[model samples]
Target: MQSELIHDSDFGRYLEDFKEGMVIRHWPGKTITESDNNLFSLLTMNHHPVHLDQHYASEATHGQVLVVGTLVFSLAVGLTVREISGRAIANLNYSEVLHHSPVFIGDTIYAESQILSVRSSRSKPDRGVIKVKTTVTNQKGEKVLSFLREVLIPKKN
Candidate 1:
């Protein structure tokens, strides 16, 4: 007997669906660990004591070890790539990056992205520009990171 097949829901968005002011909240939150902070800091050549040394970080404002800022930013951007611009032709630029709050170890993070603008490319008829604002929040509902980025995506035929 032959088995039936099932298809999973698609996570990627089509070009026509990229509308201005559209917001998309990504699923699958990730927790930051002490080890994660240390490893990321070491791997990226960021030897900041605030991220690596718990004793030193404990004396800081938050009184605890904080996650590397760049790591959190990278994670937030990575989370939205699949649904927003996994098939992007090119990344144009990034702007208005703000670090609203510190991300501490053991904090779970999730992200949401809002489509700020979309414009058809005059030179490349088959591609278009998409500008989006991404915000990342910690488990305590604190906004840790936010940024605006632009990318080029292929048009749906």
Candidate 2:
């Protein structure tokens, strides 16, 4: 008897399904809250006043607590996981991260990604690398963050 393998349709895309110009918008926007920012800051040991101190922030440029930049980046990456890297073999690189605007508590964030490049591995024929640029935007449609990352995905054989 022979056994067959099953692939879940809702999981990440394979290398063969990717195109250079493909774009994907992630669902279920996340709302940043005071607790979210504070917890993330505390967990990451990023005790920055601007992100945790409302009083101090009131005197700063934004005049409010700014969400930690790393937290925003983490959320963006997490938002894309289901569609982009859910089944990825590995994450290869991340670069060109830019913070375009400040994020504060109560700001809702959404993310979208565009495929930049795809190439099969030279040594490993069953896997390939996909480079994508992901953009994060706020409720007002203002771009808050953007970054480029490369992930290794398996090819559907």
Candidate 3:
């Protein structure tokens, strides 16, 4: 069967679609490279040795270069936007951010998000709060990072 193509703007979803415990796995994982770490660290003005200096990183706990935590977090969030929050009104906040393990160059990362809770906004009848737990894992199925975030989503009229 042929599937119809749905444009981003034309695809609208209701709050009920984001039910609690619903898990959305983002496909086409990204492979982290040496250049990615270096560029991300420099772009963010984070000159930390763990991410920028290979020699220094070799002596650290992991004995290798580490990907910046923020970069991983941003990538995870970016991966979910298309499927989860393409039409979101606003991102409320992030909580429970944890760096469970270090990410190294050449590692592939995949993202999964679980809807945690939802609540109707009192002031905004057309919007509601959607809380989700996002996790980034490597090819080995090891979770390297995770966080909880909430966003305001428009309700179906």
Worst 10 residues of 1 by lDDT: 1-10
Backbone clashes under 3 angstroms, per model: 0, 0, 0
On TM-score, who's better, 1 or 2? 2
* TM-score of candidate 1 to 2 decimals: 0.90
lDDT tens per residue, model 1, 75-144 = 8888887778878887789888899998888899988888888998989788899999988999989998
Task: Candidate 1: give the clashing pairs.
Answer: none
TM-score of each: 0.90, 0.93, 0.88
Give the better candidate number (1 or 2) by lDDT: 2
Candidate 2: regions farther than 4 A off: 1-9
Q: Which one is best on lDDT?
A: 2
Most TM-score-accurate candidate: 2
Measure candidate 2: CA RMSD.
Answer: 6.5
Question: TM-score-based ranking, best first?
Answer: 2, 1, 3
Candidate 3 TM-score, true structure as reference: 0.88
Q: Among all windows of ten consecutive residues in candidate 2, which has the lowest summed lDDT?
A: 1-10
The regions of model 1 sitting more than 4 angstroms off are: 1-11
lDDT of each: 0.83, 0.91, 0.83
